[model samples]
Target: MSQPPITPVTTPPPDKGGDDMATLAKGGRTNTLGFILRLLGGLPFLFVGFRLYGVDEMGRFAAAFVVIEIFALICALGEKRGLAQRLTEGIETDEDTPANLVFDAMLVSLVVSGLACLLLITFPAIIFPNGTGSDFDMWMIAAIPAFALTEILLAAQAYRYDIATTVRARAVVEPWVKSIGITAFFFIPALAGGGIALAFLAAIYAALLTALYSFLRTYGLPKAWRPRPRYLSKMTSRALPLIGADVIERGTRLLDVFLLGQFTSAGTVGIYWFAKEVVSLPQKLKTSFEPILAPVITKNLKTGNMDAIASQVRQVGFWIIALQAGIALTLAIPGEAVMGLGGPEIVGGTGALAILLAAEVIASMAVVSESVLVYIARKRNLAISVGVITLQGTLSVGFILLVQHWGYPEGFQAAGAAAALFVALGVASLVKSLVLKTLLKAPVSNWRWPLVWAAAPAVIVGFIFTEFTPEWVEIIIGGPAIFAAYFWVIWKYGFDEADKVLFRKNVAPIDSDLNASN
Candidate 1:
């Protein structure tokens, strides 16, 4: 039997201009909405877990959760961003429909997830050495297909510029289901112990259903779909570099947990997990941007529009850094109080929380830079990611061992690990930004002294509040006050027309004002 001829995919000429502004506006709005929903839906679960189940049980759940997430990342096969890039290419050239692209990704994801599941089942000890028990470990494996499928579905919608679908499934459906399920299950003595893991599995399945429904509603069902070896090879080959980068990128988060499991106690791991979870909230913004940014970057790359690409990277990088910096300041200002809310046992992780938040702030540049480089310099990008993770792993283990050698208390181990993470991430971000800057010959960071000026006053105010006021009072009064001060300074002196355009419905007036001011 003869194979179908492959349709040649061609790139469309770039728009004259204005595309970056439009994409940023739409992406920013949707991502912001998603971020808020995630915060609302997700935080409740952490509070419930810490308040009800305490640190140890949550630690057990955290252990299993890490394994499940690592496998999910593996099964995702980098399709989250890679699929967006491929879909953009197909749509631009009319080589394939959305259904075709989604179907291809789904098929690959299913196979990879299946393989991963089998491997986990075969060597459960290798992945979960502390052991989440056989039943919980099985549940972890069961969630992989759902996890992988949801990612692909959401990426498919993102390719269509329908980020709201991702927001709905991930932000609204998944987190709420988990939060509610975990709360309800805690009431039953039989199910109370593993409620977190159970709720997590339930949430993934719910998200999978939601994603499938949304994807089909938007793209319709696949037609005349048949698996082709050649097509699979092409897709996998294109996705391989991304798979390496994505796994290593995500593995950075899991590395501390894995190493801590080996070198520290479960209770300490739980405290660190809680702190990591809280600090990681801002990271949702970066993930939100990637889906939308991938297509824009891919389109620009196709047209050889390096200038537009750099401009987009710089703008988005600054946007992420600005927001993350504010969030970090807010969280880290009342760091102990923030952790206290989780539970008394976890409050000791305040130092870790502060350090991890700093890591997120520094990582903004690396995240946005890698997004652009992955398309243009796939090999180099992968190399950088590998280097970053290698450095992170080395620093993490070394710092952990040093703390032990110094006879520091176990409670301080997490902070030591977090400090190592900060150093490793700082090094990685600096190097990655330089590489992107050299490659593009344009600025990859839009940050200026004005941002620093804005941050200084906010930090000072936060410090004063922390020293004098109660935890609740500081959080209630200081958090918003700091953010307002930061934004006020930014608006008064730092924000340019492009930044203002993110807020305005129409860019023409802002553009005019910018010209007149100039």
Candidate 2:
């Protein structure tokens, strides 16, 4: 079929200062809500998996889940970010409608997911090299389209700044459905073993259906549903850089598992996976900003407003670092107890959990920096990711081998892998930050001394409680007390004007007086 005429996208006019801040604040609120829902809905599944099925079954499920997620990312073709960029450019220039963008992304995702399903069906061994069983293998293949479509729909809604749709489908509906389904299936003798995996598959389809209904309600149906081959070609080409960056990024998360599978048992992989998943919660706070930041950055880029772009980056970067630092301290201080919740067998991953959490904190700068660079210097960003992941892979394998050869305990083997991850990520973050600084000719000063000050007290309190008290008291009481102190310190001393703005409040008058006196 003939392609529609391409509309040339133009630069959008610069937004006023207050307007920009207001946009960010709104995005932050919605993203935070989504984060909370995800935590509430998702945590139960983790507990259920570990509590009911135990480590080995959960490990097999994790392996299958990882493979399915990787394929979904591939089929998404980077539209999670690309769609936002495209829509921002198109909307600003009035060259395309929301319907068309959604339609195009949906079409591309369907095609790519179909092909991925075929590939998995053709070579089941690729996903389940260790044999995930026939039922799980089938469930994994069946879930591909649903997983891929949910990604596209969420991206589409994010383009409209309707993050609540994602929160509803992903955080609320999907996880809850899976959790309930798994719990229900536990009583059935025949379905008990692979029930969690099946529940997960059912949940994906449910979420996809919810997303579709939400999309239609919010944006209505596509006006002209034309399947233009050239449109698909253009989108694929545009998304290739993003695809590479995403694959490399996700590879960092899964590389540990893949390598561990070779060296360690399924139970070990399950332990590592749980630790990684827990540490990743804070990372989500950073990602939540992307859907909002993309449109703002793209708009500024169109206007050739490098100053605005840098300011946004610095502000958002600092916000993320400050929050993440506090979260890392909170989680890592009671790491052992937190892991213990997953059962006695998984508590051995405490060291790995602490190391991984630290890695996320160190890597926050690079994560925010890459958000900007991906739009400005796509190829360079991709190259940096490739280099980082290659380094990570090498170190991970070497560390595993070294630990095994040195006769370290099996538990420490995971710690060694995690340490390798921390080192690679820390170095990569430093390099990426420096490169971004050079490009922007602006310093990314997200770190403040007060963040350290705030974290110190929280960590001290958390450590005391975790060490001296029972696990329940440590997690329930200590966590809240530590976080309370952290937030109070941050409020009294660490918060800047931008942070105050998020709360719709100005700096306190006493602080202003203190500043004036100084």
List the candidates' TM-scores in order: 0.93, 0.92
Best prediction by lDDT: 1
- lDDT score, candidate 2, position 368: 81
Off by over 4 Å in 2: 1-14, 91-96, 505-518
Q: Name the best candidate (by TM-score).
A: 1
lDDT of 2 by residue, 1-518 (tens): 65434333233345554456556667766676777677777778889889998887777677767788888888888877788788776676775667777788778888888999899888876666566743654666788878888888887777666677777887788889988888887788887767787788889999999888777766676666788899779988999998887777777778787777767777877898888878766777777687777777776676676666677777777777777777777778888888988899999999999998888888778778888888889999999998998898899889989988998876788898899889878877888888888887877656778887888789889878987999888888887788887888988898866666656633222222112212
RMSD of each: 4.8, 5.2
Native-to-model Cα distance after best TM-score fit, residue 504 in candidate 2, in Å:
4.0
Q: Which residue pairs in candidate 2 collide?
A: none
Model 1, 1-518: lDDT tens per residue?
A: 65434333333334433655566667776877787788778888999988887777677667767777878877787887898777766776877776887898888889989898898888876566666732553676789889988988888777767788888888899999999988998898888767777888899999999988877777777668788889888888878898888888787777888778777777778899989888766777677688888777777676777777777777777777777887888888888888888877788899899999989888888888888877778899889888888888888889889989998876689998898788877877898889999998977775677878888888888888899999898878888888887878877787776776666655542333112212
Q: Give each model's whole-structure lDDT.
A: 0.79, 0.77
Structural RMSD, model 2: 5.2
Off by more than 4 A, model 1? 1-16, 92-95, 505-518
What's the CA error at residue 311 for candidate 2, in Å? Answer: 1.0
